[model samples]
Target: MIDVGLLLTMIVAVGVPSLVARWWPLTTFGEPVGFLDVAIWPAMVGLGVGRLVAVALDGPSSLGSLSDLLIIRSGVEFWPGVAAAMLAAAWSAHRSGVASFDRLADLVPLALIGYAGYEATCLVRDGCYGPETSLGIRPPGTSTTMLPVGILAAIAVVVGAVVLHRQLGRRASWAVVMGGLTVVAGVRSLAAIWLPHIGDGLTRQHWSSIAVLLATVPALTAGVLGGHPATRERQLLDR
Candidate 1:
């Protein structure tokens, strides 16, 4: 069973993003805007809040639990923070006259980088452990394989974005990057679903997978509509 505090944290993480989308009228990457646009800040804040909560609940040992591997999944706690971040980001983009979706597309790489960084920090601070196996490779003092994977993913996202940006132009490249992210995220979810019991700790990959799929619907939608002159014309009139 998941710890009550951890459960609460997960719930908040999932809920925040949905609430932001419902509350704010914005779109991300040509998709109907939801919590992702505003997710950055709230996620950051949540990290802090989560840490404090952990300290209060378990003292310094909480840091060791950071490396405990879990599937990236969404829950009530995570989404709300994501939604808040998305809301803020969308509003800022709208006010600046940048296409909210387009802006978000460009920022996706950076966002991933930040997220990975956070995960790495958590691994160090919490000292979580992964499964023990003959094939397992542990970093200096940690017990999980997540650190390397996290770093690799982060590098891939950032490098891909940079290369795509240079070759395809910002808007097109961002769309491609985000589209790829959506696909990778989806595949990861599927793997989690199939394996179900592979990761060491409580896996949230299930929630993350669902959220990514949901988010992709809007992203693809926006990409399609954005290219239509009629949509642009309608948007101009609405503005």
Candidate 2:
């Protein structure tokens, strides 16, 4: 069982800064750097390392086993997903011509908040709660008591959307929202791996999950790149 209080605390820690950014946006005297720019790489690096380690030691098959699922559900996958999405979103923002890195720094705090919230959801769902353990505190109906990584990812999404909104305007906000939903769908699709034998079967469920991930990579890239400052500035200047 995971400690709900600690899980919530983690979410708050990551999330509040982003909300604060909305009000007291980060600034170097007066420049704005989007929230995604700051938080994306760090979150991604953390997630990439965790996933790489798990895959290296246990293989992909260990990803959705009951024990593994507990970990995933606990938000183990949150940071990686946030990292990937943030990178993708940042690239999209840069390409969109919405704002420069200097102008966007203020947005990082908000994105962190969203990532935290997302991970908290995972903790409640027991997605990555880990196996039974005798150490630390455990929540009811769970073996291990650890914070989920998804909370951080969710915080990223929330904050990312705000940053996109601030930089790219409403259109980018919509894109962020859509992209976030797609990621959720992809996660759900992958979650089927937890189902007994369903994951073992060669079917669309697995393929769909892979497809979503594959699709997300390019879509996110394009979104970020397409939203670059030079491009948007030109578009605005033209209009």
Candidate 3:
């Protein structure tokens, strides 16, 4: 049987962005970005990529049938999903002939909120546990007391999103995209500290998170130091 609770949560997670993006008033290169493209395409594409990646990582034995692969209850790779979603968003913007960076800035918070909501569902589902820890509370039905990595990561992402929205949402800048992603990748890195390594003393998530942090931090710094060209242009146009 399908998990009704998780299914509903997923729907809400995706739905909120789709509804809100319709009226959020975002633009790229002085043109409005398509709401459905921003809010829906990335998420759907990401889910598919994440699911496939997870199954591949787990090996063919994990894939019982086409139906099994289709059902997300099995597992999904979080990092791959995020990367694919971002690519999908960029592609959507590109297809619409927009520069994408400014549009991405406005969309970042909504994406983070939706991501956090989806991760929150990890609390009730299997396959999201952290390494066995005697220090923290144990999830129900599990004998080993795990670190509750999923919920903690979800909380961290939500907090990051709120902070980003409050601090930078008023102005459209590349910082929103870079900063939001930095926070998320940092959270993933932290979570990886408690997760068991698949190989080489680091989980794939850890490597991915580190890579993102490295790429985004410098870009975020430069954007802040130089000021967003779009924001500056907007200021000049207003004057």
Candidate 4:
């Protein structure tokens, strides 16, 4: 039987943007229907790429045939899927004449909240987990040590979204949330440090997290300086 929890995770992750956008007050950057439009193709691409990357990373032992490789539902990585999807969505949005950055700005809060939903779903489904240790309280239902990171990740996102919502709606302020996520990545890495599964070496995400932190400095700085003045009119009245 198909895993109901996993199915729910996918649905919530994809449907979140639409749910959030449905009641949004007027804006120049996004249409109520635009989130799904921006998301659909990229989601397809992300799933394909994420599954392929998993196949490659897992090595030849797992794959008996090309047909097995085509099956994406069994394995997927969030970072690869998200990265690929974001790029695809960005390109697609640009091609479709949507204001890319502005839409992305609009997406930050929704994405953060959406991701929290993903983290919550992970509690029920086997998903991104951290090291085994007593440092953090175990998730209520699962014995997994990873829930702390998910909790922290959710907290960081919510905090960033709250912070951003108070801003004058500068597109650059969205980077502040990016920076917050970068910080969460570091927190996850630190949590993994005590994990037996990870060992002594820094994982790929650790390196990527550092890279994000490095990028975040400038992005946050630029946000503070006022980003893309052309977007000034799109601002939702400074609060």
The per-candidate count of clashes, in order, stands at 50, 71, 0, 0
lDDT of 4 by residue, 1-239 (tens): 77787789878776765676675432534444555655678778878778777777776665667888876666665567767866776676587687665555555556666666676566666554555566655655566654356656656666765565545254453664564455445545555554335457776656665665676667677766776655665585553
lDDT tens digits, residue span 69-186, model 2: 4454233443345446555545655665544433233344354355446555654544544333454335456555543334334544555545544654423443454455455545
lDDT for each candidate structure: 0.48, 0.51, 0.74, 0.62
Model 1, residue 129: C-alpha shift (Å) = 4.2
Tell me each candidate's TM-score.
Answer: 0.45, 0.35, 0.73, 0.71
Higher-ranked by lDDT: 1 or 2: 2
The best candidate in terms of lDDT:
3
lDDT of 2 at 108: 40
Worst lDDT run of 10 residues, candidate 1, spans 68-77
Off by over 4 Å in 1: 1-76, 128-131, 135-156, 163-177, 180-205, 214-239
Model 2 per-residue lDDT at 235: 94
Could you tell me the lDDT of residue 132 within candidate 1? 44
Q: What RMSD value applies to candidate 1?
A: 11.9
Ranking by TM-score: 3, 4, 1, 2
For candidate 2, the per-residue lDDT at 220 reads: 60
Error of 3 at 101 (Å): 1.1
